[model samples]
Target: MATVSEFVIERIREWGVRRVFGYPGDGIGEFDGALGKAERAGEGLEYIRPTHEEIAAFMATAHAKFTGEVGVCIATSSPGGFHLINGLYDAKMDNQPVVAIVGQQGLDSLGTFNQQESHLERTFSDVAAYVQTIVSPAQAQAVVDTAFRTAITRLQPCVIILPHDVQGQKMVEPGPEMWQSRSSAVAPSIRIAPPLEQLQAAADVINAGERVTFLVGAGANGATAEVLEAAELAGAGVITSLRGKQVVPSDVPFHTQQLGLLGSRASYQQMKDCDTLVLLGTNYPYGQFLPATGQARAVQIDLRPEQLGMRYPTEVSIWADVKATLDGLLPLLTRKEDRSWQEKVIADMAKWDDELTAQAEQTYDDGVNPRRVYQELNKRLPAGAIVTADAGTTADWYGHYIRLHDGMLGDLSGRLASMLAAMPYAEAAKFAFPDRAVVCTIGDGAFQMLGMNELITIKKYLSRWSDPTFIVLVLHNDDLTQVSWEMRTEDGNPVWSTSQDVESVDYAGWARLLGFNGITVTEDDDVAAAWDAAFAHRGVTLIDAHTSKNVPPLPPHITFEFAKNTAKALLSGDPEGFGAIKDSATSLVTEGVERVKGALRRDDRDHGDDGS
Candidate 1:
């Protein structure tokens, strides 16, 4: 008879899972042994063990994001399971389907203070949609089936725990009439779309307004053509959430890159001025950047029913797959006769482009401008490249500079915004599509935290990938840059020197030690050459970019309250404030000009004013 561990391994592949990310431990020794036997036979999942269980979980989530399949990760009890939580929370927050298989002590060891004995159900309850522990051999199949099912249907993480002894036990067949003898089948692919009446109602809202803005999100993946068709028909300006940045081409005339602090000024104005807001598959959390309450008549369409109308008040809501819903609604929308609104959006983006160029070229005393790193890479990115960014300043630069062409992919921890996910995510992308080049953009603070370990994991698997262009763009600012900025902008406080400073590392040295090409960059003149060498390298390459600590990753719009607080903090002798203020003086002037432009436009609407 097959052992329970062997059966579980086989069952997941039947559900179309080909890869499993994990770290090993004695608690899961039985499952590891079974997997080993299958690998020898060349008939099992391609399991990749990350440096840590946390990286494993991060890889699992990234696999799901890149492949659009349920990602599976295995771990042992206690520390292994605990380490997986942050990455699991990342998946839970991002609404990705991931299944975690964790191990525990034997059933006999319950309440006996056994080593690595953990009741993971209580711990994972908050992050996982379904949590269960297998007890009897008869219960194995049902538990495994339910975990995958729940994860797929709910678009959330699921946890399955197995006691150490139970996995290695002989498979015992229960009597047919027994309650535990239930059989299960693999789930089939599914597509969902709302009824015609609901789609028609949403289209009616779009057709009623002249200045419409479409806010797109990751849920709109695979619906690029539909988004464009619907937008063209309505003459709408497109604003994507960071998660949905790759869903549409950044170069489109009507598209205004992204919307939020890390987003574009054009995106900000598109939201502020639009009379109609059409939300497509996005629950963009920041409400202030959106039109004020009662400012726009809104329409929201999404696959998740619970997400509809929760962010903003919508006159019509459609709960369905974004691609199918848009296809259905295309006929109902009427092409706008006036192209003025879209033309104005195009002009705004063009103007914002000039502002971004000016910001990127600003001189920094310590090193090259931080924004210049992303800007240079944006120009040199190869076709079909996959880009991943860690949380903090990297995300700011990525959101501000990186442009995703069709067929290219880009993602990060998004909602959870975890620090070290970018490296693992880039690794997983390489695993999922070995032929595609992957560029990981991360800051020094995050890179020092677990990202360096994952580089070893990359070294282990680098030969397996067909494309040799695996690049790690490490920004060295010697500070927890994002947190420092948040303290200055959000809290209205000076930079806390003790907690914010980071220990510098030879980021390129580590890569060279691992037998890969490594480049250290400090001067602005060396930036382009560093990127060129990294991309052209036939193996993993690291660019240790010494960026300026004082470069502020400015928001699309700064609130008056935040401005006053920033002034106060600078006046209070924030260590880096003076230099940062000097660097950002031109940006302040540009913001003031935009504000005047906005005031005149609003005043025009208030009175009866002529066209621009």
Candidate 2:
């Protein structure tokens, strides 16, 4: 008879899980033993032990994102289980398929307040699609099956709580023939498709509109070709949600930029002006960025029925795979002859590109410009490189300036927008695809928050990689710049001094101590060369580039109120804030002035008769 641990591992292996990101602890001995035994055998699944439970969870989330399979992570009871919360929430919010196996105290403890025992199912209910405890040995197989199935089908985190006693119990014997046959059955492949009537209804709505805008998301990843075809036929200007940034290539003719606060001016204008919006598998939560009610009609399509119209009032909702739905709807679409709307949006995108390029090229007074760092990285990015960005100023530069080329994939920390996910995500990407070059842009503030320990995790796994090409770009601004902006906006000056202040550390030296190839970049001239050196390094590398904290991540459409409030706060107290505002405004005005001068010169030449 197989022990519960053996059976559980066997089942997960049968489901095609190759690696389990986890850490061992008190209540998980039996499961740990099983992993070891399997590894000793030729058919073992690799058990990668990260330094912390949170790192393991993030790694699992990234694994699932990089691959289409359900990623698994494990942690021991109570505190260990709690550590998995942040990463699990990250997975849940991002809608990645992840399975978390939590070790619980012995079943006999019986509500006596055992050490490291807590109500895990209750804690995880909000974050997981399936949350349950294996109360008995008989329930083990069924619980595992359900957890795997639910996570895969729903594309969310699933939790399986296995008590110490339950994990040690012997699996009940089914007949040899029955067990052999049943064990081979993996999770079934299921595809969701909408009815013909619903598809036709969506098509009718889309066809009726003169100016259509397509907002795509993560769910539309593999449907790029089909999305372009549908956009062409419908005369739709495409805008991506941040998570869907790489879905529609920036090089595409009709494709604009992302939407919401970190979006582009072209995207904002497109959404504001479109008559009808087509949401293809993207439930972009910010309704403010979308067309207000009564302004435009909407057609939302998704695999999940509940997600339909959750963000906006839709004229028609179709429950189906994005590509499949598009394939069915395309043939019915009335091809539009007027490409004026699309052409105008594309031109606006070109102008926005020029603005961003100018912003990236401009040098800061005190330090190397942050945008220039991304610009340098963009120039040096290897073929098929996987990039990850953290949530502060680095995200601002990465999101605004870096252009994703074809065949490249990336992770945007979606709903959580959590700090320090960049390093873990990049490390996980490297682990998942060792051959691919992995780069992460992280802020010094976020690096101090959760990045140091993860560097050790990378060092631990670096030796295993045949072609390790992991690079971390430390945008060392020495402040919580995002929070600083918030403080400057509403509160007049940052009062939470400890929270915003980041201690200056030689990150390159620190990385060197952790056994990584370290490079420090302080000058603009060395930025590209530093990145090239990091890429050329055979192992894990870190490039610490000192950048300015004064720069702000201005939104695509900054309201007068926001600017007024910010100016009020800055003028009232801080000179740095005043300087930032003055410099940014001056740069924009200067660019505008130059453009006007160029326009006048062109007009004069056009009207002037050849030197007469």
| Best candidate according to TM-score | 1
Model 2 has an lDDT value of 0.82
What's the TM-score of each model vs. the native? Answer: 0.95, 0.94
Q: In candidate 1, how many Å is residue 226 off?
A: 1.1
Taken over the whole model, the C-alpha lDDT of each candidate is 0.89, 0.82
lDDT of 1 by residue, 1-612 (tens): 899998898888888899999999988889999999999999888999988999999999999999999999999988899999999999998989999999898999877888888678998999999999999788888889999988888889999998889999887665676487575756844468778888888888899999999999999988999999999999999999998999999878888899989999899999889999999889899998999999999999887789999999999988778898888899999999998999999978877777777677766887788788889999998889999999998999999999999889999998899998999999999999999889999999999999999888988887888887899989998999999888888888999999999998999999999998889998998999999888878889999999988887789887798787777777688998778787666567755665667567667867988756
Q: Please give the lDDT score for candidate 1.
A: 0.89
Q: In model 1, which regions exceed 4 Å deviation?
A: 172-178, 188-190, 590-612
Best by lDDT: 1
Q: Which ten residues in a row have the lowest lDDT in candidate 1?
A: 181-190
Off by over 4 Å in 2: 174-185, 490-496, 590-612
